[model samples]
Target: MSGLLALLDDVAGIAKMAAASVDDVVGQAAKAGAKAAGAVIDDAAVTPKYVHGFEARRELPIVWRIARGSIFNKLVILLPVAMLLSVFAPWMIPPLLMLGGGYLCFEGAEKIWHKLSPGGQGHGGGDVIPEDAAHLEEEKVQGAIKTDFILSAEIMTIALAALPESGLWFKAAALGLVGLGITVLVYGSVALIVKADDVGLHMAAAGRLRATRALGRAIVRGMPGFMTGLTWVGTAAMLWVGGSIILHGLAELGWHAPEEMIHHAAEAVAHLAPADLRGAVGWAVKAVIDGALGLMLGFVLIPLATKVISPAIRAVTGRAAKGH
Candidate 1:
């Protein structure tokens, strides 16, 4: 019947619309995820340390727990907050982004400063090993989750800022997709990094072929250097992304000199390159400038943070706790 034919056409049209919407969501999520690459990379690089010294069997479980906490942080807590900001306080996004970006720069520069400074305390030091291993594990997991909340906040905010102007449901869908996708990506990479050595060992010991054993040995030998490389890469990414964010935020807030100067400098540098490579060269130059600026800003902030901000915060919290 004609009626049945019309219904079929209508259903097909609806399906097409649904498919387009899904595509849009996926595209937006990818863009948003890319925008938060610095935080995401740092999350992956930092998480493996929480599992350090744990029993092999327990490593994945701890990662799983942290991943779950991360999901909760993004989806349950941060997502709604981001939505509220978008709805009610959209003007706040740039400032919040710059704050988060400053944090990234500080963290990156701090790592470098510690590396270069004499008698500097490293992250691995000063742990009071409790008698209860289980308690210690729990404490580490909680600590990691707490740390993740900050990074997750940055990631979600960056993603939200990156999203195009759209309806509530569309933004929500993109954010949810971004959160879930990023969690899976970060934790999945962490799992692999953590277990690589174990897998290598097993392969070395039990591999049927000589080549397999040799490859496994190579993996075991290579893992430490690989981790160190990952850390450095993460640090660099943080600086680059953080600096870029701050510069963009400043431009958005009506200070255009920094961005304009950088652009002109990049163009000048790009002129020397072949046309095909000019874009890439220009981008690299801009990123380097941004990172350099970020490092300077970070150094300026370091003393302020260590001497003033930290002490002030501790004092206030101390007073509050005593009053309570």
Candidate 2:
């Protein structure tokens, strides 16, 4: 009886530790996910276009396929790579983060450059009409999954960087949480956005209540503008987050002038604001500075990426650029 009681106590203790570890993983995952919000938002914003022009019944199914791909990208691919980096080459994280940050900056800058330049590359949504129904669906799913892989890589790196020092298992658990949680959040949101029009149309056509019908009409009418707004927000976030990461990374690498200058300037600006608003003012000022820096860096990188990197990618992959 004594031995059994002792064994039971040991089992209970292990359970308690396991529960505590789970809590830690959840808490860390949330923080890390928030830190990657810029990419997360962009992921959510970009995915809906993949389902465009599909049949109403097919939209959710398409989103489901993309969601499954996204999960595979994050959990199966990114999570293990992140853990390996953590264990074997922790020092590589900073440079890798800066690389991802630069990519974000470049992406945001390229969009802006396109907008300002005459006949800049247009943001092409999927085919307005499928060229070959089955093939087109497969192509769109492949493209979306590829894009998700890039964004998922960024998200995982950002999450890994944000994590506090912990055991390898703990870090793995936290990243798994971050990966799976973010994939679901992003694709779940995409599913809703894609289906919202159908939902609205149904409500508009069938709702018995006048207000309900009106609300449905509003939703249908509002979606285009809402998506556009979301795009702009995502772009801004990319710039802000990218620039901030680069600045911090540079500081970590022993170049502190930009970071310190931005800090002092933000403090000065904050001091002029009312007490209640000082923190917000400071953060806004810093974000603006970071975004400006990101835009500048992105502009610098544009020629290199286009002239050199794109050609290399094409050579290696045996694929031409998609658009003329």
Candidate 3:
């Protein structure tokens, strides 16, 4: 019948639209995820350290716990908040992003400060946490989850900010895609990284070929240094990305001088390099400038945050007496 043909045609058209929307979501998610690569790298880099002190048997479990926590952060907390912001406080995205960037800068700088000033309050990252049968795994899990929440917040916010200006549903789909994609990328990589040593050990022990066994032994030996390198690289990334975000946001809000100056300075540095190295040189110079700014801002915040802010916060919360 003619009516049946029309209905079929209508259904086909709807299917085509759905397919197109899926493509759009995928496209936007990829772009947003790419924009968030620096944060993603830092996330992957930071998580491995949390499990370092654990027994080989416990390492994967801890990573799994953190991965679960990261998922909860994005789905339970950030996704909803992102939706609300898209609907209600769209105008506030830039400022909130800048605030997150400032926090990153502060954190990255504080690490440098603590390194330079031996008497500074040392965080657990510096401690030699030993693995004991009597250890409270639950507490460590909680600590790691809390840390993941902060990093996840940064990732989700960056992804949301990078998303294309689209309709609410489109934005939601893209963000969800981004969140799911990033969580898998980060935690999946963490899982592999944590288990790599075990795999390397097995290969080293059982490999029939000398070359294969040698490669495995090399991996086992190389992992510790690789992880250390990743940590330092992650710290640098946090400073570079965070400071760049703040500068870019300031420019968006009408202060362009810092950005312009940095650009010209980077260009000047680029000229000192051969053509092949020009782009790499420019990026290095810019990253150093951004990191320096991050360090300065972080230093300024720490004293004020600890001495003035902590006491005020304690007083407000009636915890001043407990400071003893």
Q: Best lDDT goes to which candidate?
A: 1
Q: Candidate 3, which segments miss by more than 4 Å at Cα?
A: 1-9, 116-135, 267-284, 310-324
For all predicted structures, in order, the TM-scores are 0.96, 0.93, 0.85
Give the per-residue lDDT digits (tens) of candidate 3, residues 1-324. 999999999999999999998998999889888766657787898778777656788888888887888888888888899989978998888888888788788777776777678776445544335554326567777887888788777877888888877898888888888888888888899999989999899989999999889989999999989987786677778888888889988998999999999999999999999999999999999989998897777778888878998889978778656765
Number of the candidate with higher TM-score, 1 or 3 = 1
TM-score head-to-head 1 vs 2, winner? 1
lDDT of 2 at 201: 94
- Global lDDT of each model? 0.93, 0.91, 0.83
10 residues in a row with least lDDT, candidate 1: 121-130
lDDT of 2 by residue, 122-204 (tens): 65565446457678889989999999999999999999999999999999989999988998899889988988898899999
- Clash pairs, model 1 backbone: none
Off by over 4 Å in 1: 121-131
- lDDT (0-100) at residue 179 of candidate 1? 95
lDDT of 1 by residue, 1-324 (tens): 999999999999999999999999999999999999989999999999998877788899999999999999999999999999999999999999999999999988998898889876455534434466689789989999999999999999999999999999999999999999999999999999999999999999999999999999999999989998998888888999899999999999999999999999999999999999999999999999998888888888899899999999999999999999
Q: After superposition, how far is residue 174 of candidate 1 from its true place, in Å?
A: 0.3
